[model samples]
Target: MSEDFKKKFDDVLNKIKRELDSIAKRIDEYLEKGEIYRAYRIWRDAVLDSLKMLRNALNTLGEEFKDIKFSEDDLNNIAKYTREGIREIVDKLEEIGNRIRELRGRGYLWIWFDLKPIKDLFQEVAEEVNVTMDGVLSHVEKFISSLEKAFEDTGRRASQVVSVRIKEKDLELIDRLVEVGIFRSRSEAVAFFTRRGIESSKDWIEKALEHAKKIKELQEAIRREIGGEEGEEDKENQGKP
Candidate 1:
């Protein structure tokens, strides 16, 4: 990976870590309230969703590190440990919440308070796992972007130029045609207007020559009008003499 990509990855990773911390903290607080199993169900769902994000982040890192020339042991370790740990904790929390619900229905007031501490423990563990996962994901995205750009640059450099040829007479005709707006320019006219088969015929060439003559006549007429205006001005000056 390039230095630029590394720097961007670090910055993004830090941000992800902070966001995960906030989410985990909120989850912890919600769990600690320990209302009924029905109330904690929403919290359970949220935690499950966050686990998906963590898993995705880990997968991205694994893929990114596969070809890199650095040690990814630490990353692999974190991902493996965090994924399993979070999954286990989530399962235990759900079980405890369910049990507390059963006890509450039986009029056992003690389970309600006991549930709160367990919820807090689950929340703290979640916070730590999420913070780490967030950082990893941000870096993964940055590295992927850099690799994509590098490959694109390589492709651009491999481009080759094409050769083209135009006859001198055809070139001159293109210029003349452009001057009269028959086409925008020689290249445009040749590219789009000139039919290869039709232009190859003597008849079509002759017709094009005729149009060229007509254009020359129009130019000459324009020149004569200017000359006639100048002559009129000269005569008017002589009349004053």
Candidate 2:
């Protein structure tokens, strides 16, 4: 019976080692490839495997792991990290969203002038658009300032409530976006737009492209007019000479 138990224990240990090695390899590959989405998936699987291993080890020790309680400090620390990560992600997403909104407004402003009668365009719309743009840019400026202040405020107990809790659904939404190449990762998507003040809120890039073509046409027309005038001057000079 003693020999049999020893053999079983050795098998379980080997199985656990294999699981850990696989998890570690996955992590290394994800990190090397800079694949944040894959990294998160691997990390989650590793956590699940670790929990299972812990349970099995506890079982081997003749204790029911599920019945074991966590200390208050452990729970609190977990909550703190979880809350901080969620809040950071949400803040980044919102920053990207605000940028997209601003770009959409610019797109609309450009379109509103497209051969439309001056009388048909609402004066209120024009005024509101300007006001909204100012407001958003101002917010962006303030956010840059407050962002530093936020780091300072983090350790204050009063600011703990400011943390956002990211749920599994939030991560799922980001993962789907990542798969489509709209984002390399949730962090990249958030970082790219937040710094540039753009977002996936609307097809602003297409609109901007259209707007750019129109401006180019206008510039070419102006250049042709100037060239024509120069030609006319040359002709007059030739006749006078």
Query: What TM-score does model 1 achieve against the real structure?
Result: 0.26
Give me the overall lDDT of model 1: 0.46
| lDDT, candidate 2, 161-207, per-residue tens | 21222235544654555554556655565445445544353365446
Residue pairs in clash, model 1: none
Q: Going through the candidates in order, what is the number of backbone clashes in each?
A: 0, 0
- All candidates: CA RMSD (Å): 26.1, 26.9
Error (Å) of candidate 2 at residue 222 is: 36
Q: What is the TM-score of each candidate against the true structure?
A: 0.26, 0.32
- Residue pairs with backbone overlap in model 2: none
Assess each prediction's global lDDT (C-alpha) against the native: 0.46, 0.41
